[model samples]
Target: MELFADRAEAGALLAERLPDARDPVVLALPRGGVAVAVPVARRFGAPLDVLVTRKIGYPPQPELGVGAIAEGGEPVFDLALLHRLGLTPESVAGVVEEERRELARRVRAYRGERALPPLEGREVIVVDDGLATGGTARAALRAVAAAKPARVTLAVPVGARGTVEALRQEADEVVALLTPVDFRAVGQWYEHFEQLSDEDVLDLLGAA
Candidate 1:
């Protein structure tokens, strides 16, 4: 399978598919997505912003997300997974509280008091580095939907083929460079899959 050298390369490739992206504001899911989004924003001559969302991970396996929480207290969960795992309502609530704290921290760190740009009547392009199960992306799409934008599109460099198709039901348009049937992890498609530090997120947000 092919791999991207870094997010700039991914963004450049994504830009070619978004010819209608002109004048559309770009909102990036931070930490990793910021790297992939900057080039797209630059290419489209659009303002850049951050959209903060946190995953509600399973208690035992913190990296395995069962759901996600977006800004404004909205939470989306994988009910089937929760039932299969026999997770209690209390357990899910606890996870939500923990993720909420992290979400609040990220919002303050990324945006401070800068209100999220009004998406009403505006074309908004949501960018992320990649999609796996797409729990977080679904949460973001819900948040964006609440804003009543003129249009909502999701752009990612790579995704699992099934996940990309699932996302199509939520987003008005979905643009991805690669959709691998044998997808393993988001990092597998990136040669430099470094963990973006908090400083990296801050720097990218500042640059935008």
Candidate 2:
């Protein structure tokens, strides 16, 4: 597997190939995505913002994402997965309710009542550290779309080849540095794949 020394290096490399566009904004998925996005935002000289999203996981297997919840309570469900798991509407609702609470908390902590900047008629790039199931990325795209951006792009340093291809349909464009066919998990591509805490997310945004 290919390796990145850290997120800063990865962001710089990804930023190098992005097109120069006017009024561009970089919206990053927290908490790992923020680390990866900092350098890209700095390099592109674009405003940096956070796109908060939470995955709706199966009750039994919490890691298996069945859908995702974006800001403003927008939800995108994976019907096939829900059907296969035999998850009832009530069960799904419960999961969504819990995730919504978390999402609200994150938004308040990250943005503090500040309205999200207008994306209408502007170029917006959504950045994530990596793509796995693509649930969070899809939710982010949907949230950004609501603002009527002229174009939406998904930028990542590494991702599973299949996942990246599938996500392309959801965004106007996708830019990925590495697409590994044998991908197991996103962490495999990074040397220091440490988990970021809420404090870390808050601190990063505060500094920016």
Candidate 3:
């Protein structure tokens, strides 16, 4: 079954299950998650903000995320994976630098001069299109937690069971619409899972 037609549709459907929050704010992982977050923010009539995180992928295998970095937070490494890959801070410094540069560009593009909304003592809902390794999500959660939110809910339309379970430890609450054991990839659950560009992200934020 097609769980979602697209990110927008997924966001709308996911909004139905979210609790009616007080003093809530929606923070989205930019590029794709922004699409999934727009409706959720609208559903609660809450303020929307961007929570940017960049994946630190393995060298020569850019798709394999070994760690992630969020703005204003230290890089969160998968120590076990790093050991297995024989990667160290010195080894991945180049990749981290590359991702950091891209992350900065994205922050500028999506946020521009607007300031990040205050998260302290607020009900923060972090929305993403889906969770795979959960590396980026983990980094984002840690960054948000450092700001001392009253509560943090990690919300997603779908995710692998193991990844979702691991995320529960980082978040105050975990809300995933689909936790299929047979999960292969996030895009597999959606009929239209197109990659989101920087312009797309900015457009969504602008409309919100």
True lDDT of residue 107, candidate 1: 92
Model 3: CA > 4 A from native: none
Question: What overall lDDT goes with each candidate model?
Answer: 0.88, 0.88, 0.91
Clashing pairs in 2: none
lDDT per residue (tens digit) for residues 1-208 in model 3: 5579999999999999898789799999987899999999999999888999999999888899999999867889998999999888778998989989988887888888666798899999999999989999999999999999999999999999999999999998999999998999999999999998888888898898
Model 1: CA > 4 A from native: 88-90
Q: What are the per-residue Cα lDDT tens digits for candidate 1 across 78-190?
A: 88888889986567898899889999998998889888888888999999999999999999999998888888899999999999999999889999999998898999998
**TM-score for each candidate, following the candidate numbering:** 0.96, 0.95, 0.96
Residue 103 in candidate 1, Cα distance off native in Å: 0.4
Q: Where's the lowest-lDDT run of ten residues in candidate 2?
A: 83-92
Highest lDDT, which number? 3
